[model samples]
Target: MYCAELGISYEIVPTKFDEVKKRPFTDINPNGRCPGAIIQYIIEQYDTEKTLTYNTLQERHHLKQWLQFQMSG
Candidate 1:
């Protein structure tokens, strides 16, 4: 959703979303980062203009903390 809102071009590869339990993707992404981490990474890499975030250094850290909280849950 943030990717779309930020105008980042992407495609839906249905095969990638296949049953993970049946066909684990650990072979592809060994680390297997959580959803929040992935989202935060995308925002950091693509939200260069900080449209979805803020320019303040403190705000960025706060965002990361929140992302971690989501991961913990």
Candidate 2:
């Protein structure tokens, strides 16, 4: 939903559950559970226009903190 709202195009690459613990995906995202982190990374790397997010230090930290809080539980 967030990705769609951001107008960030993405592909639904279906993979086996067991494959998640392997190489390429892990290479991109260290942990599968930290999806929020992955999304943030995507925004940083590809959302160069700052549409999905801004380029402010405090704002980015706050957003990261929020994402971490959500993943904590």
Cα-based lDDT at residue 8, candidate 2: 69
lDDT of 1 by residue, 1-73 (tens): 8889889888865754344323366555554433576687888799888798998899988988887887665
Pick out the ten consecutive residues of candidate 1 with the lowest summed lDDT.
15-24
Off by over 4 Å in 2: 11-34
Consecutive 10-residue window with the lowest summed lDDT within model 2: 28-37
RMSD of each: 3.3, 3.8
TM-score of 1: 0.62
**Per-model C-alpha lDDT, please?**
0.73, 0.73
What's the CA error at residue 64 for candidate 2, in Å? 0.8
